[model samples]
Target: MLAHNQDSLKRTPLYSLHVSLGGKMVPFAGYDMPVQYPAGVLKEHLHARAAAGLFDVSHMGQIALRPKSGKLADAARALERLVPQDIVAIAEGRQRYAQFTNADGGILDDLMVANFGDHLFLVVNAACKDADEAHLRANLSGECIIEQLADRALIALQGPKAEAVLGKLCAEAPAMKFMDAGPHEIAGIKCFVSRSGYTGEDGFEISVPAGDAERLARMLLDNPDVLPIGLGARDSLRLEAGLCLYGHDIDTATTPVEAALEWSVQKSRRSGGARAGGFPGAETILAHFDGGASRRRVGLRAEGRAPVREGALLFADSAGGEPIGKVTSGGFGPSLSAPVAMGYVPTNLSALGTKLFAEVRGQRLAVQVAAMPFVKNTYKR
Candidate 1:
C-alpha cells in the first residue's frame, strides 16, 4: 500500500461509518483508509471467502467518456486509441478489464471500462487516477468528453452471497452475470452497479452519489451476512486469487504479457485482426503477443510456513548467487493457510514445479513455482 502525508490525507464518504465500526485507519493512496475492523484481517479474509464483505473503495477514480458526436461507437473508438482492448466491440451494459500502456509496452495503469449505452465509464486505480485523468484528457479530448465523477462514492459487496445480498435491494442484481454492468436503483438510490470485484469472488461494485453513500452502505451492512472489510483483507483476497496489484505485481517496467495478463488483450486488437494495433506500445506489445517476453510473472509457494515478503531476492539455487528475480507481492494467504507469492522469473524458470530460492531474513528459503489462484475462483459466470 502506498503512503501519503498524514496531514493531507483525504477521507471517503464512509469515514464516519468506518470509525464507528472500530476500523484501524491507515494511509493508502493518499486517503485515510480502513485496513481492518475489530474482527481483524485474518477473520475478515476468511469471512469474505465464506460469506460477504462490504468495502469502501470510494478512493478510486471514476470518469465518464461521452462522445461529442452523440454516438457510443465514437467514444469507444477514441478510447481504443489509448488501450489495446477492442473497446468499440464492447456491448452496451457490459464491462472489460484493460490497461493504459506506455510507448515502451509497459503498463501505465490498469482499469475497468464499462459501456453505459451512451457513454463509457472508467474506474482507475487511486494512486494513478490523477495522471490517468490527464492522459485521457490530452489524448481523447478532441473526440469525447472526459468528465470525472467527483460526486460519486464507490463500494464493493463481494463473496459467494453477494448476488443474494444485493438482489434483495435491486431485482436486477440477480440477472447480472460476470462482467455485467449497468444502472439500477438500489434502496431508492440511483447507482451504477457492476457484477465485478477485486476479490476473485462473485460480487458487485456500486457507484453511488457521495451524498447517499453512507445511507446505502448502512442498508447493505444491515444484512447479517455482510461484514465491513478493509484494505488488509482486500490485499490478501486478491493475492490468493492470483490478481495483480498495480505498482507492485505490474508497473511501468512490466508489460501486460509479462504480468500474465495477455488474456485481457482480445484477439480483435492483435495482429491481423479487425482493429489490430493502434494503441500506445502497439508494436512492442503486439510483438510480445507472437514472441513471449523474457521474464514472466508466476506464483510461488514457500517451502515452509514462513512467508516470503515483497522485495525478497530470488535465485535459481539455494546457494548464494546473483539475484535472478525479486518477489513483487508475497504474504501468507489466509485462504490457503500457507505462504503464497508472485514474482517475475525467467520464462524458462516459470514452469510449475520449478524450484527456486528466496532470500528472507538473511537466509535463502526454498520456493517452488506453483499454479496461480492457490484457491480456486468462485466467480459467478
Candidate 2:
C-alpha cells in the first residue's frame, strides 16, 4: 500500500546508480527508494549478514545545530527540554540513539543525537523531517542555528565483514567502537563515519556530500565483500534485530516506558526530580515508570506459514472474544525462515510463551508473545 505512489516520487542521490543496477524502486517516506536489487530481498538480506551491504539512506533528514552562544553543552541542555536523554553528558565524537517525544511523552520520532563538539548533528526519519525540524525550532530557546543537510548522502556498511571492507578504504575504521563517530578521509574524500547501525551487526554509517555519494557508493559496491542492499532487506534486517520502526512500533501515542525504552532515560535525570526533568510528558512518563504501564511492546510469532501483518488484531488465549492488542510490524524473516513480528499486548499477556491469536483474513492464527530478536543480534560491542 505504501508503494502505490512510487511512480511520481523523487529519487535519492544514487537514483541513477540504483536504476543502472536494476533496483526495484518503491515509495518509502515520500522518496523513491530501492526496495531491492535484481538479487531480491532475501539475497540482499543474506548478503548483509554474511558480508558487507551498502544502503542509500539520503532521504533521511540531517541537521546541524549550533547555538548562537557557540556553547555545545548549552545547546544540548536546550534540547533536553524536548527529549528524555541526558544530552549534557554525551561526549564529543560520541553518538546516542534517542527520541523526539511529544508533550504526552509519546515519541514524536526516534533519532540519533550526535554531539559534534562545536555543533550537534541529528538524523531523523525522512517522512517526519519537516515536523521534527519545526518542533525543534519552536522549542529551542534563544539563538540557535539549524542547518539542514538535505544535500548530503548516507550509506551504511553492515555485516561481519564490514570492518574488513571499510578498513581497506579508511585504515582507522576498524578501530572505531560502537556509538563512536569521527571525521575521516576515505579514498581521498572527507566524510563523517560512525561505528553503528540498525541491523544488529558490526557496521559503519558514512555521511558524505551528495555530489560524491555516487562515487563512494560505486567504490564500496566494487568490493567483493560488499553489495548494495535496499529498503526491503533493511526492513527485514532491523526487524530480525528487534529494533522499532518509528511510525509503526513507536509513535506519539506510545510512551517510552510502554514502548520498552526506559534505558534512554538516565539515572540522574530521574533522581533529580521534576525540575531535573524538562522533556514533554515528563509527569506521565515518570508515573508510568513508578506504577508500570498497562500495555508493553513485545515480540510475537505465528504458528503457521501465513505472515501476520500490521494492524492484525491480537486476542489473549484466556480472554477470547475481544482484541487485546495489535501487531505493529510483522513479516517472514529470510534468515530465520519463519514469521516474526513486534507488537504491544496488555501487560498481563506480555511474557514469553504467552498464548495469543492473530486474526488474519478471518482466520484466527495461533500466536504467542515471544521474546524479541527472534534471531539473536550479532552487534560488535
Candidate 3:
C-alpha cells in the first residue's frame, strides 16, 4: 500500500478533523496520518492511561470471509489452514490475534480475527492489505467468499474510562468483556464493535460506516474523558504494553518462536493435537515448540531516563563483546515513568534479570532484562 511514484498518499476519513485539532501529520502505511495532536505525545500517552483516548485506525483493512453456507466453522476451518491458530475453537462473539506466515515460518502480517454471527472478520495492517487479500484469494476454496469492507472505518476508544464513555452512547458497550464483539446501534448508526485494542487498556474498536465515522468520532469526543489521540501515543502505548509493531518488532525474517509469540499458536495447532500441521511452515514452526529457538525476544529496562531507540545494537559487557541482539522497539513509557524497550537476545541472555548493554549514542548504556508490560496490562477480561 505504499504510495509509490505517480501515486499520492491516501487520507483517512478523519484527516480534516485531525488537522483542525492541530495534529502534526506524517506519512504512515501509505496514508497521511497524525503523529501527535496539540497536547503532544507525552500528554497523549498519559491521558490514555488515566482517561479515554480515541484513535482513528481506518487505514487498516477490514475484511469479511463469508462461507456460502451459514456454518461459520467452514470459514474458520479455511482460515486455520493459513494461520497456526485455533480459530475453530473461537466461540461466537469472540476475537483472536493471528499472523499470516510465509512458507519459511516467517510472518507475512499480523492481524486480528473476530468471529461474528455468521462470518469471520479480519482486521489486517494497511501496508499488507493488498498482498494479504491476494494470498487469501489464492489459498481459500471458492466456497469461502472474501470481501473487503472498504466502506467501513475503524475507530479505537481506549483507557479506563473508555467503557463508561462509550456506554453512554451504546448501552451494551460497557457489558462486553475483553475480545468480545457483536452488533450494536450506536448513536443511531449501525456498527460492529469489539472490546479490544492495542493500548493494553479496557476499550473497544468500533467499525462504523465511512459516512457516519466522523459524526460518531465527534460525538465520542464530546465526552469529557475522551481526547483525540494519534499515532505517536499509539506506538508508545503498544511498546510499553509489550505488544509488537509488525515491521519493527516482527518481520519476514522472524519466526513466532523467536518473537515470543508461542502462546498465539495454541496447543491445538502444535504436534500431538487433534488438528496439526495444516498451516504454512508447520514443520519448522511446530518443531520450534519442542526444540526452542536459538534467540528469544525479551523486555528491557534502561537504567536511566534516556530512551533506547530501535536498531540499537546490544552487547554482552563493557568490553564490547560480540553483539548479542538489536533493539526492535524502545521508548519512554509514560505510565512507568521510565525508558522501556524490547529486543531479541541469545537464549542464555534473555532470561529475566540478565544484564545487557545497548549501544546508545556511541556509548554502551546498561540495561536489564525485565518483565514486559512496563505498565501492567489493565485489560478488563
**What are the runs in model 1 whose C-alpha is more than 4 Å off?**
1-4
Best by TM-score: 1
Sorted on lDDT, best first, the list reads 1, 3, 2
Write down the TM-score for model 2: 0.96
In model 1, pairs of residues that clash are none
Candidate 1: global Cα-lDDT? Answer: 0.95
* CA lDDT of each prediction against the hidden true structure: 0.95, 0.87, 0.91
Candidate 1 RMSD to the real structure: 1.8
lDDT of 2: 0.87
* Positional deviation of residue 173's Cα in model 3 after best superposition, in angstroms: 0.8
Q: Judged by TM-score relative to the true structure, which candidate is superior, 2 or 3?
A: 3
lDDT of each residue in 1-381, candidate 3, tens digit only: 544721587888888889888989888998889999999999999999999999999999999999877789998999998899999899989999999998898899999999887999999999999999999999985758999999998999999999999999999887899999878999889999999999988899999999999999999999989998999999999998999999999988888999999989888888998898798888889888889888998999999899999999999996646898999999888888899999999998988999899999999999999998777888888
TM-score order of candidates, top first: 1, 3, 2
Report the error of model 2 at residue 332, Å: 0.4
